[model samples]
Target chain A: MSENTRLRPGDTIGILGGGQLGRMLAQSAASLGLKAHVFCPDPNSPAFDVCAAFTVAPYEDLDALDRFAESVSVVTYEFENVPGATAAHLDAKLPVRPGVRALEVSQDRLFEKRFLSGAGVAIADFAEIDSQAGLDAALASFGGQGVLKTRRFGYDGKGQIMIRKPEDAANAFQAIGAVPAVLEALVPFDCEVSVIVGRDLDGSSASYDIARNHHENHILKTSTVPADVSDATTRSASAMAEKIVAGLDYVGVMGVEMFLLRDGDEEKLLVNEIAPRVHNSGHWTQDACLTSQFDQHIRAVAGWPLGATERHSDAVMENLIGADVDGWQSVLKEPQARLHLYGKAETREGRKMGHVNRISTRTA
Target chain B: MSENTRLRPGDTIGILGGGQLGRMLAQSAASLGLKAHVFCPDPNSPAFDVCAAFTVAPYEDLDALDRFAESVSVVTYEFENVPGATAAHLDAKLPVRPGVRALEVSQDRLFEKRFLSGAGVAIADFAEIDSQAGLDAALASFGGQGVLKTRRFGYDGKGQIMIRKPEDAANAFQAIGAVPAVLEALVPFDCEVSVIVGRDLDGSSASYDIARNHHENHILKTSTVPADVSDATTRSASAMAEKIVAGLDYVGVMGVEMFLLRDGDEEKLLVNEIAPRVHNSGHWTQDACLTSQFDQHIRAVAGWPLGATERHSDAVMENLIGADVDGWQSVLKEPQARLHLYGKAETREGRKMGHVNRISTRTA
Candidate 1:
């Protein structure tokens, strides 16, 4: 778009996916006096309940996409897996923030690794594996151990397998439908962390405090801010995030997951992956900082000035998976716990029902 | 209403009056997984843009009210002047939180003063007046200085006149449309302050920190939390708020405005007015406290437990009236300023277009 693409308060923002993230982004838009129109196929999408308008149609429906684009000044999505064709279609009509290129680069694992490496971002070693034989060959080169992941549509430990032993690789490619994939040597990292960065249309960028993440069952369980890393490590992580966003010409908040490796106090970071939208790890910003990632994302997509990312308190955000949300009553009673429910109808196993942020005065 | 009238996630809340207060309430409800359906006559209501569903019909439209009541599990209002008949109509169908009596008492200044005095709460001395002679008589009894206010439907210093000297009261009665009114003794002591209290269905109550308010052109200009009051004054203000809510059998958030009087080294507080909804003074809680007044109101009306009311930071909430909202860019650039625009289409004079909350780490 143009440098003067800033939206006024009453402008409508079209969101492509209607999930918890979209639900939050819509709410943030409303807080700033802007309107949000969510588009999703699911009638029961949580976001539909909070937006000003919505269209229930598949991404492939060009007519619906056209109408949605007409109603909004800009378009953005909650998830990174938005079809490339869909983003291009909307981009042809209105500005689609983070641009279609960000989606194209982040959609395919091989492309993502190559782009990161080209941009001078530190990442793990990996190779293309189109078949079981190719996977086996790539695994042997990485000392018989690597993560075999599909090139597209993988999330929450799905579409990937850990091939630790020879037997573990047997039919691993077939198990993933033998799709074009990438195999990367799994780094023995000290901890997992992420930085959420917001880049404006004018190339101004701001990054929130790094969050040290923890996973259970390959699903994110908790994210604690003010990551227990050295000041140099924090600075390095932020620089990498800025570099990645600038590399993609990104114009919204992006979550950059990284692996923090420590070799006797000599810390290093490897870019793990990039989400071209708000990520679950950054939810703590909602309560711990003056501006949330959702707010920052909306501001960026609207071409408004980016907000300050300084966090006033230390926070730990824990996801309420499945039945964990049943304890909302007790959580409400906790003085420092800020609960956020996704308004999903059912609590299926492993589904992200909600999350809670527990905060305390900064000690460090 | 039953003893156990708790509303679960995914339940719909019907909100009356589609102004900025309702807009913020709807947004807060969404944050906790509840759907909000707003009802108002104006097609241009700002809250309509944020709610899940909205009815653009007058409050007297019984058929529309029935349809709206059918679509939600419970009902609440953002303003106190929600026609008693309309509130009574919905209360018969389902729970109308803060109940009909709370609305009735607060709707009339005479009734409100009587209720507070009956509840043994400290309040300003006042007398009812119906004619120019009556207003003149009441004014004389109060040292020829008082405020002649309409008993009902008065807000933002509207429907009231200050009778300072004899000539100021010449046409004051006719100026207020000759409505049945109450003349209150003019308070001349100190600062204006307010307390927001949330009472749950179980008769449990919580009070936020007292806020010292500043007004311009009879409209609220700013509210500073942790009002510059002594501990004794603070405790008194909070206790008065709790007493008022309990006396009204209030089951939602209520704003209580008071006048602080300083006598030598002693501090005194007199009840000024009561707002049976989330008060503007409490907006600071959205940024400085774990649970905002809007969040607490939703929880109360939903029959859920109340969250903590402790503020973690010092906050000053300033309303952006009319064209003041045009400075949003500068506000966005302010590191500690949190901006909230009401999405109003026009910048009419005296209109509350939005607000900004600036916070600092608590020092006292």
Candidate 2:
């Protein structure tokens, strides 16, 4: 698809994976007059409740994948764990966005680090570990203080462990089931931030303001806009996001997480990771910006013009994880609060149930 | 069902009649974590696309009605023309909102006018005509100029005819099938306006600011916020809406259409008609206010806390009728335009396909 030839209101945009991200993505697409077809193996996926059409099929089923590609104008996935073969199967027939290369790099920790470092983006020191010997050597190089994370399928602090000392290296490595992993020195950063950027079909890009994030038990708990960073630090974050998008020739929304480290009187940015889909840290954009990150992702994949990212208000977004969702009544009654709940049947420990975004004129 | 009891996220809302209105209502329900079940005889209903469950059965099917009432916690209708028997059947089993009395009144022109007049609300002069003699006498009393309309099922100028002279009364009567009808004088009003109000199950009420409306070919063309009415006129409109709600014991969002007339030194409000559900003139609230009419209706029916009805921006809403939807590209490209299109398979002349809301900082 090109800039002039774009998907219209009735066009169907197929989404891969089914979670809160897919559900929110489908809703945004519907608001813009487009239909959504969700393909997932889980029958109880929350996205099935909102999409116009859905097919309950696994990614490995080539016949189902072919049928899905034929049914939609373009395909995009909410989760990054989709096997490269599944994406390649659909990309041969139609457009699969964020592109195959972007997906492959983001799916692995080592490749993501290399891609960023090669693009002249500053990143924490890292080394790959394929064996027990490699893990021990990498830990020693980082002075026994680093994180050991599985190369694939790691999210919300899962499939990862922290190494605080040399004695903890072996246990942390075994905890990840001896899988391929990467070890990076834990930076003494002051705060965590993220940039959500979109690249259209023609490679034109736009970015939302940096979001300051807080984590509890390694899971994102909240994201506040007008992050406590200098204007120069924000500029550097946005520039780095654009560089990554161009490096991968990405088309769709991608999230870049960074650590804001204090270097004496100056602040420095360190690339932590990249999410090749809408990120949770940017949920505040739904209430604050002219167009949300979900809308931007849909626009990019549909080959439409990128929407303005100008935020109308300052915002704070809080995640309702597991038991926290029981307090939904209060969020529902709060003024200027927009509440969203994923239609999950059961809430398990550490599972994300929903989120609430509160907007105000006050920036702090 | 009561003040202390409230519907939760997993609860299902059953909607009667499948149209664009039902589609929007279902979406709003889903946004607030509720499931929607749409029941319509037509298989191609646009609302079926977004709802969790759908039953394709006519209202006359007793078995289908029984199953539907059992499947849902609460019942609401998109159109007021729901068969009396169908509503009675559902109300006997579950809570049916805006109840049977409200439906009966709004479905009949004479009944609505009588109820409004009895509640001390100002309205246009009208007289019920049971026969040809009565029609002629009513037209003559109104200076030989009046509108003859069927007491039931009249909308968008349908099932009605204008009488400019006594000679035209017979033709007008025949045009409406010579049924039990009402004659209303064509009040020389300057402009049109409407108020969208909500009544909770507890009898607590709230109203959005009046919306100024414009119609083309008797179909609603546009609605803008901050209506051109004085403070006294606005207060009078709000009071009239509350009066109608209390008179019917309504428990959902309702639309009260009125005429703004210049009566020499004073501005007068003449109640034109009341819609038992969300009104097209209130579409501006979708972008301009904290809570939309759809949200208000769902909240009221579910017995949840009514959302704040504060205006956050100035807005103008325009409907896309049939071929006018071809300019969707321009609307999509424009900044601050939130476009919504019903997933209709085909568009016919005079059919409402979708709408666009444009917001600005300027109040005028």
Candidate 3:
């Protein structure tokens, strides 16, 4: 990559996704006098509304991606599933922050587990499976219950299945299309938490306060800042996030989702996954912190100094999924709630339409 | 006017004028899922980049203005010099918040002073000057010093001249094109302050805390929130803002700038001027308040409940002019400073390139 190091205010950032994340990132970039050029295949991309420029094209089209890369000073993807080769291609022309390796590891569950486990991080007990026999053997090793998950393109509980018994192993594997997958024993964690960390070009890094998350049907419903975890757990989460980012040689904001195992005296955090881009769990930071995770990510990608992660107020961010957005007027009526709605024309079930960050000075 | 009073999330807002305030207002509207359609004569307007749609046409182009007005649910303006006839034309198609009265009263200095005075609001003693001889007459009416100002289209101390000496009156009048003007006695004030108020369609109103201001070269340099004023002064300012908005039967946000005079036993606030739209002095609220001024304005115009204007933290907002914006790097390095840059392609001296809102929990 041609490392021009730091980017100035007028620099253009090319975003690889056009969802609400990209829309918000574009808004943040605009605030800093930076322009955003979003490249997405969807004609109805919400990000197009707020960005200075955009192109509608498939990611597999290398020539189109190159033209986009030529226009922007730096490139960043809002999702981890950005093709590694595409990022590498952009990197050859300009800086692609968080690097291709972060994408490579996070996009595949097996690679993510191997990378996290190798970095002295505690993750779920897992074994990879490529065939029916492999699935059976892994299920036996897990003893009781284990999840069979396809190693790629899984989110919001898709591409995964739970095997509760030996007989259910083959059915679970078949249900997953018998693809390359991982079988993992589920841990009884007290709560799910995530820490969003930003690393600058010089390797200086900082993490925002932990957000304790709640999921409805395996989709994130709410994220509350000042997670109910103890101070020691927060310290451990911060340290682990720092270590993981350094290990990947990553720059830009990365979210670390973990399961907090509350085994009495042996309270520990087990790494569930790594999202090498801004995560929904950190949405509360937009209202609670001095700098939002989106702004921090933009700053990191621009090679600017990392902003403070201190929480200025207590906040709870709730996702407005599909019909939940029907309550937008009520959300608007709430004096302390800050409403952010993605300008999406469609409102499909299970789709993230918007979110509200309710802010207060009262801490947990 | 359509009289579709309550604007839902998906509604469109059409804005007149396309400067930084228009740009910021478009951005705020986007956050709430409302699209902005801007109409301005400048093709290079900053507001165009962030809005969903735009019409580049002169305000006198009645057909173009009507078409633009037809596409939006409501019409609001960023600058009061929105050409009264053009505003009236738009109002004929849809409800225009902070209506024609706000534009009429604020666009002309004489009308503004008269309206405020009629509402029992305190203001400087002033007289109208239609010619050079009229300037001399008004000068004599005021004992020593006065400011000669054009009745219309004056901003940032432009189209105005300070007549420090009696001999300067005719020259100042000629300098202002001998246009219809207002010559006001220069009050010996202690400081300048402003308050931003939002009034909803239902007449419910709220006001952000007073902003203490400092000017350099007739341009705003900085505004500190929770202005160092006595409780009575703050209350008086709030009451006056509410009274003015209610008197005009206005909706959306209005900024009232005042000159504070220190008396032997009383502190007085004299109305200097009123901005019908979002004002630069209220920029601090973006970082310090629960709801930003822009957001409050959007909510008010949308006919949703007005947001809380309570200040969450103390803040000092500093305008970054042409050369001052070059210090963006240094500002970015300050962890707690929130930077907002207007995306103007060129950097001209005295141009408002951006501003920074540095926030802290410490109150006044």
The candidate with the higher DockQ, 2 or 3, is: 3
Every model's Cα RMSD, please?
1.7, 2.6, 1.8
Q: TM-score of model 2, chain A?
A: 0.96
Task: Tell the DockQ for candidate 1.
Answer: 0.68
Clashing pairs in model 3?
none
Ranking by DockQ: 1, 3, 2
The DockQ-based CAPRI class assigned to model 2 is acceptable
- Give me the chain B TM-score of candidate 3: 0.96
Best by DockQ: 1
Off by over 4 Å in 3: A362-364, B2-4, B362-364
lDDT of 1 by residue, B217-301 (tens): 9999999987889999999988999999889888999999999999888999999999999999999999998899999999999
lDDT of 3 by residue, A1-364 (tens): 7375677877899999999999999999988888999999998899998888999999888999989988998999899999877888888888888788899999999999999999988898999989888888877778857888999999999999877866676577778987899988878888899999999898899999998999998999999987888899899999999999999988999999999998776779998999999999998888777799999999989888888888888889999998999998788778779999998888899999999999886422
Ordered from best to worst lDDT, the candidate numbers read 1, 3, 2
lDDT of 2 by residue, B142-219 (tens): 998988889999999998888886667766777799899999999989899999999887888888988899999999
Runs of candidate 2 with Cα error greater than 4 angstroms are A1-5, A139-144, A263-265, A361-364, B1-5, B164-170, B263-265, B361-364
Error of 2 at B354 (Å): 0.8
A166-217, model 1: which lDDT tens digit per residue? 8999999999998999998989999999999999988999899899999999
* i-RMSD values for every candidate model: 1.9, 2.7, 2.1
